[model samples]
Target: MNSSQLKPLLSIGNKLIGFILFVICAFAIYNKVLQNENLNQYGADLKIQLSKIHWGAWVLMGCLMVLNYTIEAIKWKSVIAETNQFNIFQALRAVLVGQAFSFFTPARSGDYVGRTLFLAPGTKLKGITQMAWASYAQLLMTICFGSLALFWNLPFLPWLKWVAPWGAAFAVGLFFYNQNFKGWLSKLNILQIGTGLKWKLIALAFSRYLVYLLQYNWAAAMLSIPVTGLDLSIAIMALLFFLSMIPAISLTDLVIRGQLFLLLMAPFYHNDILLIALTTLIWMVNFLIPSILGAILLLGFRLKR
Candidate 1:
């Protein structure tokens, strides 16, 4: 087909894809919530306990979810500030839209497409490559912090302490490589952001990571999980760290997610259903709802190339 004819076809295809994704996310959410109502023999008991909890706690968690993504938007905005003209509000919109695309994609890579759409068409390709830098910064935070929690959890094996120096070496390697990469990209005119700014972005990533931990902790407290302080934090980090190791689509992840949460909390709290309740809340607040929001936002995307 001629480019002229092909453009219209592509626009129709894009709109169809958006509508399909919205349907998938919405259906998955509805199905899962229906399951919540008639979960099992324990459904009556679960609802009774859950009913006793104050509505305010759920409101606070929803607020924290917004704050969580806001921090992500800030990191994204800064990285592309040298190229894109997006304000923080626009950046946030991109993040949520990215979440929608990410809901079903492998390893969540569709997020790149979602975020890049916010850039001017001329710059969208460059924005994709540049966005990876911010992503890497957040991942490096997970590795560094998760590794420490790993070391703490494995204290019985003195040899495991060897992970410390390796983590240090990895950190040093990151510093030198970042410095070299910055200059190379500068020479090539690929990206002009500073090494210092990159580090600041990593700090912001950590702050968002902390917000995640707090939300989980708050949920546990509301359910009276009976685990707190360092014990709770350690298990939560361990759960997240290990969970990140597994790959699963958000829509299909609930069963495994709940199992992992149970395994991690088994040592501290044995109320299986309550722990599952915590898992359900975390998944819905952090992933499902935001994804649905993003899918709804997809309707606003310009269908034309």
Candidate 2:
């Protein structure tokens, strides 16, 4: 197909994918709320649980989330040090705005659009390509560490076992096949992907996962979930967050995370409803809250001219 013809076709495909994702998310929410019936039973009391949350703990979690974003911005700055003058504030804004887009859009292409806003107009595309590479590097590191933790904990759920290996392989393949990786490395004359600044990038990426652990731990604490022994919940939640990146699923993350919590923690908690509610609450706080704020910020402020 000609370039113009192909553009329209691609747009249609993207829209179709988005529609499917919405339907999936809607279905999951419906089933979780309606078919389960139990969710509704405690739906009233859920507000009480929320009301009981310690403001101090909530503030601490919010700070950690900002730290996570800052670390990501630093990582991106490291990757494109030569190509552009990386500003931490700009990077953080882009990251949060990108995250806002990720919440509702299928596959999170919104991240790219948000990141592009920060780039100098002339080199927006190049900056975007580099950002994609940096993201891929982070994903690879998360999967590698998360896999080790997954196997170490070896949760009671049989299906959970398959997630680690498959995720690891896919992440590795994605890194190797990434066009941006090749382009960035070539432009910078970097021979080894794991050398110098790249190592720092990976470290920053690891920090993001650690930050997530803190966030999840705090969420568990808020829900009065016991934190004894090695906490595998963080690793499992990280895995779910990673899975949410895959395109074509509507609200798959919201459902999968809630369901997985029940499967993995129910044996210990003996309260599936509480676990699911906690998971859902945490997801809403982490994803939905930021998205709403980002939308407001984007609308209220003007971009750099």
Candidate 3:
């Protein structure tokens, strides 16, 4: 077939993929909210708590969510600056739509597909490698903080306690030596993200991670999760640590979220409806809401791949 005929077919196919993503996102969200019988029982009380959340905390969570993705957008823009630069609006749009793609895909791997396509046609492929560097920084931050949270706050086996400090040391050392890894990436003729830009990416990722914890803290305080201070931080770090390690489509991860939260918080809080409510709240605020917005954004947007 002629190139012109193929272009039309490709456009139709892209539109179909977008439509399918929206359907999956909608179904996933519906399942996340309605499928939980415990959540249904407490739905009214949760709504009441949401209504009663101090106005200041409410504003903070809203601002944090905005800041969360804004940091994400800027991190993306910074990572790709040397190769393909786009404005903040484009970056933000791409990040949100990437969330939509991540919702149903295993390990959120669809995120690469969703975000990279927004790059100009020539740079899209390389954008994958470049952007992955930025994603790794966030993973690194989770590990670094999780280790510290473990070492400083939580108690462990007499034999295993040393593992926490050692883990933290290793993660910190890895942070400083990240340049060597970057060197390998460049040696392979992968994009040279450069030294300064690498630090910028780490700083942005660290800030985003803190904002993430702050949002959870606010929600926990509002819900009375029965833990506070260092203990609260430990639970959060543990939850984030395991969640990051799990390999699953986020669209079907409501169970994982609940189990992880209960397992991590077992010491500080009893298994109860409120814990369920906290997990549900964070999931909605962090994942489902953004993915829903992303799905809406995808409706008229062109899929590059």
Candidate 4:
């Protein structure tokens, strides 16, 4: 087709994709927020909690959320440095775009899709390949720290004693494997990259994880969940690990997350409503808010020629 003919088709295609994304995100919001009975009830309870909140607590959490995503953006910026360096703003936009799509996809596969959209046509595939390394770095952090939480539970559930060590070993092995795998990425003429990148990636991921872990614990406290210190830390870690390792589809993932939080928190706290409210609040602040912003960005999303 001539450029004139092809241009219209491309426009239509982009619009179709945008429309589809909007629909998927809307469905997710409806299912997870609007239609959720648990959240609906929690909404009423949250109003009461809101009155009692120190407002400053939210300001701090908001700041941490920014820090958390900024760290992630910098990590992405570093990973793509050899291929195409992005400024902090560009990198942050790519990460938020990924977050937007992640809301409607299993295991957030849309993260790669959204991220690669910012790459040059020639570099987009390699961008995705490198993203795999970036993601592995983050997952390794979760598995390594999360293993301790699992091991802590071994006294009550002896089976974890058998599983935790092996799981830790496998996660460690994968981290090293990802490092060696960079050589293969280099062979693809796509990775022109750095030295000691693996350690850098791991360190960055750890920092980001720590920020969010602290945020989770703080959120739980604000909601009056009644667990603290080491116990709270373990529950938060376990929740993060579970959410990270398991794959769930679209809006349904929110439901699964709610259930998981309840199970993890139930042993320590008797108030199911309070726990569920806390979980919903965390979800709203972290996932839902950024996603709404991303959807607004998606309306103008277009593929580069």
Identify the candidate with maximal lDDT.
4
lDDT of each: 0.74, 0.63, 0.75, 0.76
Which residue pairs does candidate 4 place in steric collision? none
In terms of TM-score, how similar is model 4 to the real structure?
0.85
Summarize candidate 3's per-residue lDDT along 1-305 as a digit string, tens digits. Answer: 99998998988888787677677767765665566654666778767766766778767777878899999999998888877778998898889888887877789888898898678878887899887888878988887777666654444344434565576567556545544444546665455556688788889999999887888887888776667756777778867765776887764476677776776677778846677777777777777788888878777666654
Leading candidate by TM-score: 4
Look at candidate 4 and tell me the lDDT of residue 127: 90
lDDT of 3 at 85: 72
Q: Write the number of the candidate with greater TM-score, choosing between 2 and 3.
A: 3
Off by over 4 Å in 1: 1-49, 154-172, 179-193, 303-305
lDDT of 1 by residue, 222-280 (tens): 88878876766776676666566677666446666777777766667788888878777
Question: What RMSD does model 1 have?
Answer: 4.1
lDDT of 2 by residue, 1-305 (tens): 79999987777665465345335434433443353333455667677777788899878877886787789778766666665686787666666666656655566676677566656656676777677778877777667766665665545655655777787888777566434445546765332243566567767877887777777777777888775425545446545544644553224565666666665554456666556667667666666665555554454333343
**Candidate 2 backbone collisions, by pair:** 21-250
TM-score of model 3 vs. true structure: 0.81
Arrange candidates by lDDT, highest first: which order? 4, 3, 1, 2
Over 4 Å off, model 2: 1-43, 153-194, 234-238, 241-250, 300-305
Candidate 3 wrongly placed segments (more than 4 Å)? 1-24, 31-57, 152-161, 164-187, 303-305
How many pairs in model 1 have backbone atoms within 3 A of each other, for residues 3 or more apart or on separate chains, i.e. clashes? 0
Note the residue pairs that clash in candidate 1: none
Q: Output the lDDT of residue 92, model 2.
A: 68
